[model samples]
Target: MSDSSDGIAGIPHPNPLRRLTLDQLRRRTSVKWREYPEDVLPLWVAEMDVTLAEPVVRAVTDALALGDTGYPHGTGYAEALSGFAHRRWGWDGLAVARTKAVPDVMTGIVELMRLLTGPGDAVVVNSPVYPPFYPFLGDLDRRVVEAPLGPEGRLDLDAIEDAFHRETAGGRRTALLLCNPQNPTGTVHTAEELTAVAALADRYGARVVADEIHAPLTAPDATFVPYLSVPGGENGFSLMSASKGWNLAGLKAALAIAGPAAAADLARLPGEVVDGPSHLCVIAHTTALREGVDWLDALLAGLDENRRLLTKLLAERLPAVRYRPSQATYLAWLDCRDLGLGDDPAAAFLERGRVALNGGLPFGTGGAGHVRLNLATSPEILTEAVDRMATG
Candidate 1:
């Protein structure tokens, strides 16, 4: 609203973060746009409001132009992601030999769970987590065990070990589905924490399945340690994708990297599991990871500004809505308990302010009275969404 140009709410972002205006974003039929009415701003989902990186767009369009639409071949996605990890996070342990292409991160998780656990077995998850962890693991007939985060939303190592002990008791096979740079809360687990987890999993004999889709979006102030790079982490599985960083979600491609000791299990995956991967997705995701560094950097900068901007906005207009600007990803976990809006503040925001945010209740455990806000949008839109929440 200020049009001050120097910054918005003290977050310096002179470059236009998103190329599209609300009118343009509204024209799309994606879930983020179509989920709510025209008047409502949907900042709930992880979808970015920005356009695709230039290389990704070029790769897709070039493939279409050549009429090269067909099933994917080779381990290009694996190689691409391995290279990305080495360059992006200084993790050089990934080899194409230990990677596999899956339809997406969720698909990879299910397949990995199948390899590690059986039906009716237990799977440990950090609470106030990504909602799909419940249904996805449930579909596998695996039991869901909670290891809720600590009071400050950081990993509760004691709670994790306690859950691992409970779940693995009596030789019951189980897996730990970890969210590094965790979802909703966006607390990037320190390398020390991750190493502790790896050791605990080893001691308890439970496999670790890390869903690190948000690995690349970590803020400059934070460090993202690739699980496999740590000692004892060699037994875990890390799933990653360019879908979040490059806005390639519609293109279905994801990679599951196995540590040295877990390669055999990944190799045991059924062949048919690879059927859902799209060739176009592989090309786009690969191109983005391999060549879209500039665009990705710009996007991260914008996201950094948006995260800071939201902090200032809440402090000024809606101080009651407790928020912590995320260190990774574009999500802001807002503690709305002080608003006295009950367990599901999202509903009230939708009904009253016409702003749609992710409901905290579904995240389970600590989720009640919390809402996860997406900050991957234009500054004006972010301002409008928060303003709507204040009034709503």
Candidate 2:
């Protein structure tokens, strides 16, 4: 192959609004079904239906060609992340000083448990969150203090503060785990919201771990505030990955960006604890951050269009299913209680409608009667899925 900047297709024009059709994405995944299973649509997982960006594919392929899938060792890995952080979100130099490589967001959360607190310690999580948050904490033998998020699908600062106060009164060590651009709700916390959280965490001597994996997909009307960029955020840790936004979960690369103090805590933990994907993941992660910006922009634009299309379709066709426009990411938080699905519309969709979606209860209590849809597919697929679901 002729030598090019990165052995990938040249960057396309910057059209953040560009997108591939759902049929194209479905064909690319080579999805298998028995006769397409009578109109079944798969939107259960967060996987995107798009092809891998050329730069990311080239990087991974090049690394594999080198024939050693050994452990990663590259200075540029962290630097690329830092550059992406600065360029994408204006958070500078953090990837160098505070970021540490990990296998994925789950590992980071588990590690935070080990690094920040002990068994019986209180960890506050707003309900209706990613399902893994519950088990990840449970497996650590830690006590969970749930601040039940309100009906509006927004975080309640008062409840969070009360949880912290109760924990403090009982003399237990406490920490807060924040899901930014929150999962299953698509509520992107504002700068003020983040600062309010930081204040609560700081006031009680508790640490905050902000999961910002979805920040990259912030839609046009939404604001994605990096938890660490907010005031009092210096005392917290931010966990992120290219996986969620770039369809790179298969790469298994994530980082934990910390403040000086939090970094010290993670550093003191033994190296043996970090078991993750190999050197190829490092190359993919770095390349995605450095040379994949144009592709990411395209992907996000596609996601925005998909979100809008879904909202309009539901409004016009499936009036029973209520949905709000997403501020960031391709996930749609749909309230299906009006359908009388009785707290598990996902199951109804899958069994009755032949459509696969994530049930809301997995996110938290308020998640009941809701379903989270992955809109990373083509618009046609989204429409078909909704059509089948509505008919059911």
Candidate 3:
């Protein structure tokens, strides 16, 4: 692969995913590497197979050297995110004052849901989504109502409206947990679609909490429309992080952004909740958003190539499997029903092919016979995975 210049001190930016070898990855103690045996090629989780960005590494090390391991303070993380949004997405509406620091996206979502709804209230989600949405809300005592995505893996606004009307009929409150640039399927929601969602939320008196963790991973050809940037979205909330884009999940830090109209609700967030993020992680995430742009661009380019490569490999080898190139994120949703595998094709892949993938059943409706493949790895590994699946 050719190097992309950052134009800063004439430095070249190479693909981060290609920086580490299989032997190096095997040494990793993270869940992605340790989940399966040495023979099984693991590609199930959202974790990326890449090295950390130089700036993020530098920032964290500098902080550690200075013993800056205390609690987080200041608006640096939020400010950096605002600048990133403006530069990358042309979104100038991420006000620093309306933002709060949280441990991660899911925790932020739970806290926001607490502010919006009480127990037994309904939480609407597009089905065949991130698996955690089901158990998380259920554990909170909030009913998980499904508005399955349309056949083409796009949002079904009609299903959403129906869910909203049905859930709110008994004077119960409802909240929509939107997955922007959806997980597994990787469909980036369009601006028109988000605007319609805001309108429907207004019609049904439902609050919208968007999980926009995958926003920065959108392919160059696609546009990621932030839910709070749309019409009638002033009451919505969003959670964003550099974890997915920069591969800093273990660091654990995210920002909770509230629309202008929802500022008061955000203010209700407890002080202890704001104290959850690791101070060192805030430094790392902030540095990633502010100075890791070039590295992120290179990673995106690598992911784009991997997605296309997967398409060609599947066509040539696993022709029975159907895969649509994702518009965003380094995840490819594969329809493996025709492969003669059961609802959980991942099980067959692991046992027979020695390649671990996430099964579709746990992702809720429309997920049977489907598998989610991680496309954020070296091209060689990805090609080998496809070859193994084909012969298995």
Candidate 4:
């Protein structure tokens, strides 16, 4: 909470995650705070426990002050995302001409899948992924195919290729709903791995639609490879947003970026779909990407510290529970099979520990015996959560 500047454009860059007290967080009405009872420490959802960056707040407030609530126009979101990608991931392949504004990452994925494949077609996903992939694709009447991650929680090329081969049989169209810097596990896919995936998709005539909303939250030690930047990935699509990185989820805006070869298909996105993002949200997301780097850096530092802290806390207090420090995002996937808890450890944690975490069951195959913990909170809360889990 110190006002001391950390030297980025003379803006103070203290750890945003640690700035707010538990009482302040409890006052929040967001789902992360309100999903459970008042006594429960909620850390299940993707929402971050941080204040908005100054530039983002200023942009949204100025727009509201001017009554600038209206339909979005122009390529500001794409342009801002392009600059952020280049600066953060060294990715310059985000072609502004091939980008479309979408409501959010999951919704964008749904629309993109609709464009790429039809009902009864297969949508291959790496299992133990974002739970929404199952239901969202199901809503489209697309068959959900699982290619579970490897033992280490990284993609399994063999499993992916096998699924690709099986799903593409009988001339059925397929699409791969990839999660770059995967949710829950936080394994940042490498360029080599993505290239291989692209090759498999190419071989099987399957399109790749990546949910890259978590792209910006990759740890300092890891590199996030935009799927479109890989060889044979020209037909891939990526959905990115500053919402996750800047804690702007309630604002709701994201970009659907298409590879060079997929531009034509993306152009076919319905006019109604293109009109989905909130104008105010576009301004907020754009400002965050364009001017909030210092704040994002401070947040990343704080999350990295929390990741390490969780490791120590689990090792000391709940050694039986296994947690692999994630390479991206604030979510931590913990293996609780060793703790003698049932398949849904999150259930026991919630009831006995008075803490909330995302259960692994709904994530599909390879999800049982695991739970996803949100590490975007303060160290004190994280430590206390672990202590409660230990006694529970």
Taking all chains together, each candidate's TM-score versus the true structure is: 0.95, 0.91, 0.97, 0.97
Error of 4 at 117 (Å): 1.0
CA RMSD per model (angstroms): 5.0, 3.5, 2.4, 2.5
lDDT (tens digit, per residue) of candidate 4 on 61-107: 99999999988999998998998888887889999999999898888
Per-residue lDDT of 57-139 in model 1, one digit per residue for the tens?
77789999999998889988888788788778888898999888888999999999998999999998899899999999999
Lowest lDDT 10-mer window, candidate 2? 29-38
Q: In candidate 3, what are the lDDT values of residues 1-392, reduced to their tens digit?
A: 22212325556578988988899999999999998899999888999999888888888999999999998889999999998998888999999999999999999999899889999999999978999988888888999999999999999999999999998897789999999989989999999999999999999899999999999999989999899999999999999999899999999999999999999999999988889999999999998888888899889999999988999999999999999999999999999999889899999999888999999999999999999999899998999899889888
Where does candidate 3 have its weakest 10-residue lDDT segment? 1-10
| Cand. 4 Cα-lDDT | 0.90
* Candidate 1: Cα lDDT at 112: 91
Q: Which segments of candidate 4 are over 4 A away from where they belong?
A: 1-12
Model 2 residue runs over 4 Å out of place are: 1-39, 93-95
- Candidate 1, pairs of clashing residues: none
Question: Lowest lDDT 10-mer window, candidate 4?
Answer: 1-10
Kindly report the root-mean-square deviation of model 1 from the true structure over all alpha carbons: 5.0
Q: Which model is ahead, 2 or 3, in terms of lDDT?
A: 3
